[model samples]
Target: MIELRSLTKNFEDKKVLRGINSVFEGGKCNLIIGRSGSGKTVLMKCIVGLLTPTTGNVFYDERDFCVMTKRERTLLRREMGMIFQSAALFDSLTVLENVMFPLDMFSDQSYKERTRRAKYCLERVGLLDALSKSPGEISGGMQKRVAIARAIALEPKYLFCDEPNSGLDPKTSLVIDELIYSITQETGTTTIMNTHDMNSVLGIGDHILYLHEGEKEWEGTKDEVLGSTNERLSDFIFASDFLKKVKAAGAKS
Candidate 1:
């Protein structure tokens, strides 16, 4: 689990995050969602230690991440797994090799042990058949799966995904969402995702944080989102005609 206490970030004079406080529970999908420029990305970065909070605390499983020394931070990072908005796989490496990269760099295990772990992660993602293929040879969804396999290769305690379903068809997006959700539940990992995808919001959003203009505007489960009376959140959520219709239909039913 992760907890934020008065988390704030400032870029010179412009404030990016303003005293945001929330709890992301383990063994569930905790999502951060907002319109562009709403500070979701900055919030995620601060929580992951990529950016420093100007005047706040970020606690990881009750450990004060903000006060950790450089070496301590480095060691703590080994327990984290990250998936970028892009698949972010290396074109020069095979899929299996890509998954092994983290293990080789961080793990103290022997080469054979690392290989076994990498293979197991690939199999878990159902990509064992594509181990030898390079990132360039696969479709976008396959590349994302390889990225997921690589992220979980270390069996991390915390998983961070930034737009994991970006740039994929609806079918592929659902596949990725289900995969992430299942892995989070099975491993009991503290999963935090920064996404703008509404499909993801309703599909696997066990806990949702809604940010607006650098502050936490609302927070709730997916089931409560549609019934929310917060006008700004409602406007942002039902921006499209299709979603508006869905909301109306739900209201009617």
Candidate 2:
């Protein structure tokens, strides 16, 4: 599990995150959602160590990440995995090789061992057939799958996904969401995803954190979202007529 205690971040004179406190439990799909510029991305980056918090503690399974030394943090990162907004696969490498990259860089495993592990991860994400294909040769959804494969290649204990469904069709997006949800459950990985996709939130958000202008506006499960009384959260979520209709129907039921 990951816990944030009074977390705050500042950039020059502007503050981004303000005393945000939350816990992301393991073996569940923990989602961070908000509109653009809500500071959701910044929070994710801070959790993943890309950016440091100005004040507060980020604890990963009881370890205070902020106080870790360079070596300690480097070792800690080996237990983490990340999927970016884009698939972010290497253009020149085959899908299999791209998955193998992490193992190659961090593991002392023999070539055959790494190959076996990478192949297993690829198959886990339903990319067995695309192993030999390059990133450019596959569709965007397939590339995202390959990226997922790579992210889990090392069998990380913590997984972070930044808009994993970005740019994908709704059907494909659901597929990716299910894959991520299943993987997190199966591996008991502490998974946190930064996304703007409402379908994803309702579909796999075992835990949801809503941010507004750098503050943790609300937190709850998808079931609780429909009944929320927070004005800003309601306005942000039910901005569309279709969603307002859904909420009304849900209320009637």
Candidate 3:
């Protein structure tokens, strides 16, 4: 499990996160949801050590990430995986090579061993046939799959996704959501996703953290979200008439 204690971040003059405290349980799809500029991206970056928090502690399974030595932090990075908004696969490399990149960079395994591990991860994400194909040759959804395959190649203990379904059609988005959800469950990784995708929130969001401006507005499970009494959360989530009706119907049931 990952826990954020009084997490606060500032960009010189502007504070982006303010004393945000939350727990991301292991083996669950923990979602950070909010409108653009709500500071979700900043929070995720801080948790993943991309940005330094101005004040607070980020604990990875009880170890304080902020205080870890450079070597220790490097070692901790091997236990973490990230899927970016753009799917971030190397265009120069084939799908298999992209999946094997982490293992090649970090693992002491032989070529044959690394290839075996990469193949297993690719197969897990249903990309066996596309191993030799470059990232440019695949569809956007398939590219995301390759990213997911690469993220899990090292069997990371923690997974972070940033707007994972961005630019995909609704159907394809749902497919990616299910794939991520399944991987998190099967591997028991502490998965934290930063997204504005409401479909993902209702689909795989076992734990939801709602941010408004620079503070945590609310936190709960997906089921509890529909019935949430927090007006700001309701306004943000059920913004459309269609979604409002859905929430109303869910409440009635």
C-alpha lDDT score of every prediction, in listed order: 0.94, 0.94, 0.95
TM-score of 3: 0.97
TM-score of 2: 0.97
lDDT of 3 at 34: 92
lDDT of 3 by residue, 52-164 (tens): 99999999999999999999999999999999999999989999999999999999999999999999998888889999999999999999989999999999999999999
> Against the true structure, what is every candidate's RMSD?
1.0, 1.0, 1.1
Residue 169 of model 2, lDDT score: 96
Instruction: Name the runs in model 2 displaced over 4 angstroms.
Output: none
Tens digit of per-residue lDDT, candidate 1, span 1-253: 9999999999999999999999999999999999999998899899999999999999999999999999999999999999988889988899999999999999899999999999999988889999899999999999999999999989999999988888999999999999999999999999999988899999999999999999999999999988899998999999999999998998899
Structure candidate 1, residue pairs in collision: none
What C-alpha lDDT does candidate 1 achieve relative to the native structure? 0.94
The residue ranges of model 1 lying beyond 4 angstroms of the native Cα positions read none
